[model samples]
Target: MDGTVVTDRTAETVGADGTAGRDALNAAAAASAAEGSRSEALRTLSRVFGYDTFRGEQQAVIDHVVDGGDAVVLMPTGGGKSLCYQIPALVRPGTGVVVSPLIALMQDQVDALRALGVRAGFINSTQDFEERRLVEAEFVAGELDILYLAPERLRMQGTLDLLSRGTVSVFAIDEAHCVAQWGHDFRPDYLALAVLGERWPDVPRIALTATATPATHREITERLGLPEARHFEASFDRPNIQYRIVGKDDPKKQLLRFLREEHEGDAGIVYCLSRNSVEKTAEFLERNGVPAVPYHAGLDGGTRARHQSRFLREEGLVVVATIAFGMGIDKPDVRFVAHLDLPKSVEGYYQETGRAGRDGLPSTAWMAYGLQDVVQQRKLIQSGEGDEAFRRRAASHLDAMLALCETVQCRRAQLLAYFGQEASGQKCGNCDTCLTAPETWDGTVAAQKVLSTVVRLQRERGQKFGTGQIVDILLGRKTAKVIQFDHDQLSVFGIGDDLSEAEWRGVVRQLLAQGLASVEGEYGTLVLTDASATVLGREREVLMRKEPKRPAGRPKSERTAKGERKQAVDLPEEALPVFEALRAWRADQSREQGVPAYVIFHDATLREIALSLPADLTQLAQLPGLGEKKLANYGEAVLKVLADHGRLEAGTALEDDSSSSGAESPSGD
Candidate 1:
């Protein structure tokens, strides 16, 4: 096999400005392989794999494997990961045995290779005895290029014996992060993969997964017994998706509004926390005239498969499900991913939202976040039979997410910081906070009052308390809980009367976000940490941001358009007509294509086309959201509209400056 070999690099290596590095990697591979007297294999690799050259660090990873070094790859999804191991498999020896976790994915991979005219087969429980025997015979005859295996098969009596009989080209573990208990989806069978080295020491191994924090990374290496494996991680950020967290009083109503106005007729996933919630939410959407189906482990396998197929084949079908629906389901054009409930961790959030906008199209990641969701998720994590340390870490991550929800600052900034990366600007100008522009106040006094109350109560009752009781006592409300505990006698009891119950709740939430407050599991009570001491003593100042209550039955149009809510919309009469026409066109395209209307053309894109009226493909492609693919797909139709209106002639370049820096639409696969 001839091809350029590339190594996987850390995310930092493939920065947002990585085109130059990718080209260099491709060029270097072309040069090195030819000089090694395998110039033919290099060219063959490119031609067969449908790549002109190698991508970032792919060559290095391929070389390590071909040279017989065990490796761990942490490439992001859709980062050309398969080629790294696949190229070496073809060149190394008789048969490359790949251990994969998903049976559905195995079938898809084999089908894809067969489409490319490669001989690939999988031996698993799904195949009958005769079928397995045929595949085994083919493997013994040294005829198969790639053989995919489930880890469960490795334990069979004849499995290791047959493996020892043949030349094992390479042992590749796909979704290798499953080896770690820290991972969202852990599989015990993955632990069996480590035995491959003992069973066949000479065979090189490659383990790969899309999402893994540093902890998962370490676990993958150790559990797989590849202590010295080289590591490669791509950047975790998905810039194409505009992340938004909406504070909702009625999440179902908000979801319906999004579906009608923005995500109508789009294939999307809505994640819920329970099987019952999944069914209820799906039914709610369906009753509202949306095409949605429920998916959970409770549903029969056939129903789940039918719903999944409909979602992939047809546009605009919503699959309301638990997080279980997303693993290995690789539908790339999902327009939106809405969470009816909060995910447990940032890692889970990133992976779940990553399902949308895989086609490099602008996509909406809309989520409704609230306090109860956080509390519920934390309770679930603690309820599990885990060690105290694990529970503490899980609680910490939950607090981080809750803080993200409570922050009136840039959502992108908070999320990026969680991953240890700082965003370029204070405002992403795309999230609900940047859009709504919530109110901010110097909350130092309020924080002090809340902290003091927690401390005073601790001294009085010798117990932890919940938020309701604390807030009631702070606001000087004579609630039964407060009266029963005689919290009224505390020095801080009547001091917080200046703030309303709602206002004090905000203060308490912010305190939690700041890590000054924590929930004690043993007592189901709020406890002040040592960090709260300074604040309570007036040594530190605290500030708070809160959202103004949304007006009842307020129309969305009256709602501000985020960044330019106050900016004047000045338009010429000619431009107004054209803008309406553009909207009409988008609506029609969305209906015909069965994708979200934004998928055809986001509002920003429509504004650009209305102002510029680009006459040809070359100019349209330059506009934001109108990539080469989109231009090729809809170029003629768009230009024809402009031509009919006599706006295509003398195309003038209007100011490209729009309220949004990037076009917001659904793209990615």
Candidate 2:
């Protein structure tokens, strides 16, 4: 929001220069509400909700559905895809039936909508008979604008019968990619959604998903029977979320440092590869003065529920979890999403990292990627219970993900290209690649040394060893295993003594990524691939990114100094107090209403209100996010806050109030 000037050059794409290319979200949302000559939609967005403009293709998609046409929306996670269908549902004739995948997601959306004074409700397994019956009665009575149903419930004949009895305006299928078997978050129940095209031939259908490759995209269209729906695929770029992939050194300490240096007293999610890692990371964080809770399928149902509730309802509490957590997480204020291990695929990485900065604020997606991740992922692909085709597909996905980690080009461009979208420009000032350009060295000699050693060990000695063993032999480490194999007698032994162990590791990892070598058999032995010949013969120059030095096993020196870190919010000092006061009020209101804090207001909205420093309802109502319901509901209280803070200025910048309790160490709820 505070970036330099960038005028709108393309309407469908969100440019890398931040919000400059787009109108204010609320303003766009409000203007979008005026779809028809006399748009109730525009009023709903500004008054009931708030906002004045639409983002990317949101207005087009909304208008398509409102005009009684099917649609497919492929926008990024934080790109406001929900508004595409939500606005249309309000403006169109009857209630919209939304088939959602998860109960948590459904509830979160329902709560946020109700907070806006929109007649939204959901019926899921989480609700009892009475709760479901009340929502059903509302639908039958035409008292609801949107009804969210789990895909499983929507698949049932009883639910279909109920829908048939009511006046349904549109059928909205969310998380549409889940229909594809190749998708990482596949849901079998989603396949039944295809019947919607047959059963509700006249009802306009809108299918939406945040993550989908060309392959996954086709599967979704074919499986959902929406091949003819007007497609609105917005650029899948989150420039506000900075991407950084660091080599694994001490993961816990590295994660701790990230928290202290860049994300102090902010909400975030930490992902680990295993249940054990989740538990250990949570415990480690708590012990080291960062509040955290563990969430995994292995945890008891009640415990998991409580932890998730705490993570959502409480501010600045980190949730350390395995892949078992975080899909369709509606938390909008997460400042960072850290990965202690490499995700299995690029789709998974994109979806997980997209979870941060959903509120359109600056956030970080930090990962400690390394060689162990590569080995484990390969083992997973090879050991799958499915047939060879499935294994091959899984391996292909893993290779694509690895290439992304190893790419020398702009990370955002490569990532966008992976999704069949061309980035407007290169060098997005966000990712580690663009921010701190890593110097590349000609790795021809290093590649030759590793490839020759592997060949000699296999052809001359009839031995195939893992990467570590090969490195040990080359570094002249005559350990018991090396002595047993008599690998020390080889000509290539000690040839790689010129590079540090970490540097050699870089060469080895890059070789595996580039397909110059491959892991073979159950022993995980490394062998040269056909591609190795070019690098070994000097026909092609191997290039590698210089891996940064890993700090020695000491925590203190590893912590980046406080002054070097960037401040997340850039606002005037005068607005700082008002921002904290608003946050305090929001917390109180959320607790009173028994809803998540974000449901009442997003941090970005609060930041805007704080910086504007509007002294009364008229001025406050004009603020970007103060929708009709929000203004009528909280305008007086907000005015009281500004009045209490003395005379307000119009152009005050936003500053963080460091004195707030948010900066304190955790005393768990």
**What does each candidate score in C-alpha RMSD?**
11.8, 10.5
Which predicted model would earn the best TM-score? 2
Model 2 C-alpha lDDT per residue in residues 524-643, reported as the tens digit of each score: 788888888888778988889887765421134333356533235555666677788888989999899888998888888888888887767888888777787888888898888777
TM-score of each: 0.71, 0.88
Q: Tens digit of lDDT per residue, candidate 1, span 1-669?
A: 233234443223565788857776766675565445244336545445433456676777777787778889976555667777777778777788988877755665675455444678989877899999999998988988899998888877689988887778999998887888766788888888778988788889999887777778888999999987887765565666777776656888889887666666667899999999899898899899999999999988789877876675455689999987886656556778999898877778877888886655556788876555655665577677789988877877777777777777887777767765677788876666666566788888888777777777777668668788888877788888888888888888778887777577767767776778766574447777888888877788787776446622223543324333111123445676577677677667755754445446545566678888797887776565554446666779888877866644333322233323235533421
lDDT of all the models against the reference?
0.73, 0.83
Against the correct fold, how does model 1 do in TM-score?
0.71
Q: After superposition, how far is residue 147 of candidate 1 from its true place, in Å?
A: 2.5
TM-score of 2: 0.88
